[model samples]
Target: MRLAWFSWLVRNFGGYGFSDGPLRAAIGAGAVLLTAFLVRITLHRHRPAAVAAAGLTCALGFGWLAFH
Candidate 1:
């Protein structure tokens, strides 16, 4: 799963109209890091229901991204 996510990142780097590869990669990495940090905090502080909701939200987000 981790490898696939990294592969997707690499394949989609500079996909948002950014011409510089390194800058795009950095932005992507930062976004992933920020998401991880937020999820970690949510898991630590929130209830299981909240965690499940977060996971579901992420899945729906990825599904939207995949299909559209």
Candidate 2:
């Protein structure tokens, strides 16, 4: 499960270790920043196609995360 994987990650690389809340907040912030950067660049060049592709990618990513 995702929680198991996250725990493994924390154990391996979290140094003194981290509480889940702060770690999750940091990761979520990073994801949002990365998504915004990618969308800004792609949207400027590809317009409608970029938006569609981004939407599809997000849906697929969420589905995979939820099911796998």
Candidate 3:
């Protein structure tokens, strides 16, 4: 089932599915960033380090997964 869905995505999309992986990763990273933003807002503290750490972590993870 999962394979079928992925195949469909690859067929309907373009570039031999290369774009699909990054697109999905970007979406997931966006969600994580949004969650981090919400957490920072709820805490009511100017935690720049935390935000930067989260952003960097997400970017590294996305890069690793999307490029690996």
Candidate 4:
């Protein structure tokens, strides 16, 4: 699952552009990172698992709905 998703991300957003897939993983990654930063700033604590989950969800959602 992880490898497939990784491949999809690289193949879509790396250099494909609109030929096959949308290059929106960059946007997704940025949004996810921004959300993580916001969470860290508001929570005042560092929990890697929680931040990872949030980022993963954001990335997946963006990929499925927006990036696809």
Candidate 5:
């Protein structure tokens, strides 16, 4: 289940861009990081832990994809 989601994320990393190699990798990492940062900052105060968890998940996913 987790492998499926990870592969999906990796597949989409190059789905919409005219980039390749390190450029594509950088773009993918930036997209994930920025989206996670926005979510972390915009969540309700009552869900602080959820926001942090989501951010950490995204960061880890980015790192994994960046080096995978």
Candidate 6:
């Protein structure tokens, strides 16, 4: 099952292996920061932004590759 792999991933891989791992945590943190930054700069709520999310995905992808 998927849960089995996830649990194994967590057990072997450190914090990043968890569902709320540092990689994703970083992503979420980045997104929130990006959103706030956008609001401050644009003063708009509907403004679209993908900077933080992209950075997060790249970081996590690299890290996963490195470990594997």
The RMSD of every model to the true structure, in order and in angstroms, is 5.2, 9.1, 9.7, 5.3, 7.7, 7.7
The digit string of per-residue lDDT tens for model 6 on 1-68 reads 99998787668655443355677756765665565555445634433444444445556654664344
Rate residue 53 of model 5 by lDDT.
70
The alpha-carbon deviation from the true structure for residue 48 of candidate 2, after best TM-score superposition, in angstroms, is 0.3
lDDT (Cα, tens digit) per residue for candidate 5, span 1-68 = 99998888778766534235767667777778787777676675748776887678796776666565
TM-score of each: 0.40, 0.43, 0.39, 0.38, 0.46, 0.35
Per residue, candidate 3 scores C-alpha lDDT tens digits across 1-68 of 99999888578554432466676756766766776666656655657866776667666655554454
Give me the candidate number with maximum TM-score: 5
10 residues in a row with least lDDT, candidate 6: 43-52
Model 6 residue 48 distance off true place after TM-score fit, in angstroms: 22
lDDT of 4 by residue, 1-68 (tens): 99999889667654433334445545655666677667655655657766666676666655554434
Q: Roughly what TM-score does model 3 have, to 2 decimal places?
A: 0.39
lDDT of each: 0.58, 0.59, 0.63, 0.60, 0.70, 0.56
Better of 2 and 5 by TM-score: 5
- Which rank order by TM-score, best down to worst? 5, 2, 1, 3, 4, 6
Q: For residues 1-68, could you state the per-residue lDDT of candidate 1 as single tens digits? A: 99998998668754633335566545654564566457756777667766776666666544443343
User: Candidate 2, overall lDDT?
Assistant: 0.59
User: Which runs of model 5 end up more than 4 angstroms from their true locations?
Assistant: 1-20, 63-68
- Model 2 residue 5 CA deviation (Å) reads 27
| Residue ranges of candidate 1 with Cα displaced over 4 Å | 8-46
Name every residue pair that clashes in candidate 2: none
Clashing pairs in 1: none
| Weakest lDDT window of 10 consecutive positions for candidate 5 | 13-22
Which lDDT value does model 1 have at 36?
Answer: 49
Q: How many collisions per candidate?
A: 0, 0, 0, 0, 0, 0
